[model samples]
Target chain A: MKPLHISAYTTVSALGRGNAAMLEALRAGKSGLQPLHFPPAELKTYVGFVEGLEHEPLPEELAAFECRNNRLARLALRQDDFEQQVAALRERHGASRVAVLIGTSTSGILNTELAFRRRNEAGELPVEFDFVHSHQLSSLVDFVRRLLQLQGPGFTVSTACSSSAKVFADAWRLMAAGLCDAAVVGGVDSLCLTTLYGFNSLELVSAEPCRPADSQRNGISIGEAAGFAILEREPVEGSRGQLLGFGESSDAYHMSTPHPDGLGAVEAMQAALARAGLASSDIDYINLHGTATPSNDRSEDRAITTVFGTNTPCSSTKGWTGHTLGAAGITEAIIAMQCIEHGLMPASLNTRQLDPDFGSTILLEQRETTVNRVLSNSFGFGGSNCSLIFGGRNDHPLP
Target chain B: MTTLYLDNLGVVAPGLSDWPGAAKVLRGEADHLAEPLKLTAPELLPATERRRSSDSTRLALRAAEQALSLEAAQRLQPAAVFSSAYGDPTITHKLCELLSGTPPMASPTLFHNSVHNAPAGYWSIATANPMTTTSIAAGDESFATGLLYAAAQVVAEQRPVLLISYDLPYPKPLSEKCEVSAPFASALLLSHQASAQSIAQLSLSLDKGPETIMDLPLESLRRGNPAARALPLLAILASASGECLLPYLAEQRLHITVTPCR
Candidate 1:
């Protein structure tokens, strides 16, 4: 796996808009999970919702692409100077040399949900409803690609939670194939009634702030976010993170539940370590795909022990940001990159007591330690799994 | 740009059942009629899993079965890229209607089956293959985008790839708006290893021009079904001469020139 420079990156999670907001939240041990206050007030679960998006208006020219998901994409692109960063990238790489690959589970199904509710007496969608641009899954990638004015290859990877994480792998392969010089790889998934009640119907929604790796952990708290990163062949002067390698695999076990023993999880982690030319012991910390579900934590714990032997510290940041679903890959990837840049180990947020049955060591405090390399794990439904390793520079300020 | 060898092909669309059937239409010896595909479930999957699979999943598995034999599929365990314009509109509509009800709770099975990668997951489980699989979407350009991505992987990794593009019509409200007329699925077994089974070698490069559309008979097919985006390339593979162009990404199309090996 060749190393690609992470020239620019930003995240718009409940923690707030960019890397600074995320870094501050992690260092200050802040939790972004809030009580279920949005519509479907009956859903009795918490979520990491991006605030004030309903008020943010899309530009007139892009009004045809209006939707909660696209609005989140527009807002997230504005933060961390993400738009400006891509503009400079287009200049350096040539607009035709750069590609756009984004991941999203449900692009704008919320808009369709609204259209369905507003169906006319004839059962037709509203007059202004533009199904092609708004409800299409590829619309997310198209929206971002048009915004960046990129002319190279582009597509949307939608393998559930691992969707965005797999984009890093796609960018790497395409660049290796000499197809694209640079790529804007990220994801955005805004909150909607579908996700809110969907998980609840599955009986996987945690009413209170979720606790990962806790014996009493019941289920997950849904979160919505948008995150993006620029990956190029050469490192720029201000580049802070380098993607060393990524490993992807399917569980082949179940559709909804993970492999009870986390076989696919172990394979993804080992593959990432092997590609990075590093052993498990060299990984300073692991960002677990801990969704605070009893089954997921136990299964992943087994896999972690099978590979790393429980010496390295690990935590599930979902306790802080909830589970951002499709946007989680980029959200956690940025957090891992920030962990590499700043020697701050974020605490596994809401865990009061760790389950003693788990074999991996779970960190519960923000440790100011020497962090060199970090492995981030994102496993999705139907057994889709991706593990990304980010590290290059050894220089980091101790918190 | 690298050249990819198309080892074998499988297609299921209205009137055109297989590559041989499609070749007739491509040659104008026969006409492509607008009709529904009569598909049978792939026996490769376990009976229980097969019963639970969705129409889109069945469409992909049927194409996959035709492209590769049982022994070959098991022996190669090829990594797959399942591309679809719409995941499972039936399941999506069902879930939507369920969620809109009075304090709705979605059926967990329907929710899982609605994922874009549901087909890919089913393929992996049915074949018992552990290799990495990806499912992507790119609207009307899904077929071309998927082929380009698979070709790059096959070239860069030098391994055979199973590329499957499948889509189906939505139920009520979405059906009227969406252009998908009928169910369609196509599969291409691509490899860098040239062998006797190889039909043609395709090389593609970025062309800054308008997208190439097929002629009259196939034009409507291409316009109507998103999965029919492969018609141009498939027709070229079935023909001895002439080239085809496919939409790669925004403002750029891939000019593909096919060289027959036979």
Candidate 2:
């Protein structure tokens, strides 16, 4: 796979808006997780919920597309000048030549969840309910495309946690196939009753703030986030980093649980390495999928040890932002790029002690290093797995 | 332009059970019937998992099983692209109601099966094929978008791909908003290399023209279900050869040129 330039990117999560807030939180090791206070469905678990979405609706002209998920997407677009960057891209490649590929597990089902509460006697939902623009999985891509006024091919990938990560791969292929000269790839997922109670039902929601790879770790802290990135065939004037390679695979062993041995994770990582033409030693850091769940951390540990071994430093930023689900891929991918630029590799925030049984080198404290190349892992429900490799343009030569 | 071979086909809709049987209806040899959708667990899944499968998963797997014949199913393990406009409407309705209940306790089985890629996950487990799989959506154009993604994979990876597109109507309150009233699913085994058994060759290009609409009894089916939007293309395959346009993104259409190989 040929390298594509990540010319611009931005994200909004519990850590706050844009790359600056994320960098500040990581540098200070400040976690954005807070006690669960979302109204309606009550759960004891903490969440990385972004405040003020309900108060701030979308602009009036785009009223039909109003939803919490789209609100977050527009918020992220406003930050880091991502909207302007997309506009410049459209000018360079034409509106019809730019594709939108956004990922989301649940686009805006909160509207439907709320509508169900207000159903009338005849079981008819409120007349104002708009399922197509609000709750549909493709609404994310459609909203983003309309916001940016791009007329190219657009779609939404909904493969749970691997959704956003896979969008980068999709963008690369579309560009390689000459379908689009530049592409917009990202993910947006908002906190909803379905996810809160859903994860609780599966026994995967941690009551306290998540501690990835910790000895006393319990489960995940759900988070809502929106992130976007511009992928161009070549580096533009202010290119940030380049997408080196990506690998995707399935566990095929279980739907919610990962493989005990992490064999599928190993396949995805190995494939990414092969595609990037890089050895395990070449990666300076790894952004572990580390949802903080016992099975996930254990399985990912085995996979990491099988490939990169215990020498390479790695940590899960999920401790700070919680598991953003679908947005995790792009969020972590952007963090991997930050590690390349800022030289600050974060520790597993909120984690007290590393799991003694794990063999891999799980970092518990922050370290400043000359990070060149980094690999980020995102594994979703249904055993979908993706691994992405990112690097600084100058230091790591293209394969 | 990239081209892919349609090695095999699968169909599961109101009157369409399988490709061969449905071809008769498409070729005008038989009338299009209005029978309820028939769904059963894909035997590929274990008994326990099969019991836990939802209608969406069953519909998708049923078509996938038909498309991947016993020979190909054993000899070639193709990566899959599962697309649906509204994935598993029944599951979504059930989960919504479950969440709206007092104290709101969700069902673990339903939550896991609610992901858009649930069928893809079940397929991976059923076939034990750990290749890459993706679940995508483009609303009403989900089938065309999935085809584009599958075709891109075939050309870029040079590997066979199984594209399964399915959608089930929502119940009651939700149904009033998005009026998808029927269940439809179809699977196409696409590859870059053509074989002796290849049924048709597909070449896709983007356009802004109108889409090919279905006629007579199939028109309602095509409009009612997102997956059934492939009726025109399927009709072309049933006949000898032709070109048809399917809706893509806003104002864009996927102009597909079909060349019969068999």
Candidate 3:
């Protein structure tokens, strides 16, 4: 697979806006998770809630497409001059040649829940409720495309947790096939009652901040975030990083539970290495999906050991931002980019001690190390799994 | 532009049952009638899993079963692409109803089944396929986007691919906002090389202007359901060589030139 240059990228998570805030939080060993209060759910778990969304609504020109999910996307786009960079890409490659691919698990269903609450006596939804632009799964991509003024192919990928990570592969294939020369790929998932309660129903929501790979690890703290990146077939003067390869696979075992032996996870990791034409030792660090679930960390430990053998320094940023669900892919991908920019590998923030049964070397404190390549993992419901490998150009030669 | 070989097709809709039966109506050899859809769970799923599957999942699995049951495709493990404008509206409405309650009693089964890729997951489990599978949506242009991505996969990986586009009508209150009256699904097994069961060769390109329209009755079906937008191209495949445009992104249409191989 040919490498795609990441020209520009931005993220808005509980850690704050842009990569600087995230790096600062990582360096200070501070966690951004606070008590869950917004959306008014009945759950007692903590969450990665962003502040000031109510004060920042969509512009009047784009008022028709209004919702929490799109608002979060707009906030992230406003950061790092992402929209202007997209405009320059639109100008360089005619507007029709830049595709927009986004991911979202529940786009604006929060508004639909409100609509359901506001139903009339006759069971009729409110006349003002906009389902097409607000609640549809495609709304996230549509909103981004219209806001960025892109005109090429665009669609929404919704495979739960792996949604956003898979878009990088989609962008690569489209470019490889000559459909588009560049793409704007990212994901947006806002806090909603459905997801909040959905995780509770599955008993996967941790009552406290999640602790990855810890012996006492219980469950995940749900989070909301939006992250975007621009990928060009050719590199520009100051490209951020390179998407060397991505691998996608299905569990073929269970819908929600991963394969007991981590078969699918192993396949995804090896496939990514094969696609990148790199050996296992070439990777400098790994961003584990490490959602803090006992089953998740246990299974991922086995997979990592089978592939990298308990040697590569790895940690889960979920402790810092919690599990962003669909946004986890791009959120951690940007974090991996930051790891390359600054020679820093962060520790699993909430985990005080490593699990005795675990084989991998889980980081306990931040370490400053020379890094060139990073592998990020994102697994989701429906047995969907995707692993992405990103690297700088100094070590690996261009294909 | 890229060229792909369509090996087999599976279809399930209001009046159309399968590809063979629907071909006559699509070719104008028989009158199309509006009828309620009756779907059964695919036999491949375990009994318990089948009983727990949602209508959207069953609809997609049924179409994939029809397309892959052919001997030529039976042994080929192809990557899959699933698309739907509204995925499992029944499950969504159910979850919404549950979440609106005071305690919010969300069922675990319903929560996992609520994902857009639930159908893809079930299909992979039934077939035991470990290949890459993706679920996507693009408002009303879901089928076109699905087709484009499937073709791109064929060109990139040089392997057989299964593309499934399906949608079920939403329950009341929600239906009033996004009205899809009937259930519809279609599956296409595409590859870079023609096989013994190849039906047609399609060349896809982007174009501007109005898309191809259907007859009065089928036009309503096409307008009501996003997956039904593939009818124009399906009709061309059922008949002979022709070109038709399907709605794509906001300002562009997907122009497909079909060359019959049967």
Residue-by-residue lDDT tens digits, candidate 1, A1-399 = 668889999888999988899999999898998987876436778889889997987889888889989989888899999899999998898987887899888888888877777788898888788887887889899898887788777888999889999999999889888888999999988887777777776788898999999988999999989999999988887887788878888888888899999999999999988777778887898999999998889999998999899788999999878998888899999999888888877888899989999889899888998788899999988789999988855322121
lDDT of 3 by residue, B1-262 (tens): 8899999889999889899889999998988887898878986677878899999999998999889963333379899999999999999999989887876668899999999999999988888888889999998999999999999989988999999999889999788898997999999999999877788999999988899999989999999999999999989988878999999997689999999887
Backbone clashes in model 3, listed as residue pairs: none
As a TM-score, model 2 comes out at 0.99
**lDDT tens per residue, model 3, A285-326:** 999999999989999989999999989988999999989998
Q: Candidate 1: lDDT over CA atoms?
A: 0.85
Scoring each candidate complex against the real one, what DockQ results?
A: 0.71, 0.85, 0.85
Q: For residues A117-190, could you state the per-residue lDDT of candidate 2 as single tens digits? A: 88888888889988899999988898899999998778999999999999999998888777789999999999
- Model 3's DockQ? 0.85
- RMSD in Å for all candidates: 2.4, 1.1, 1.2
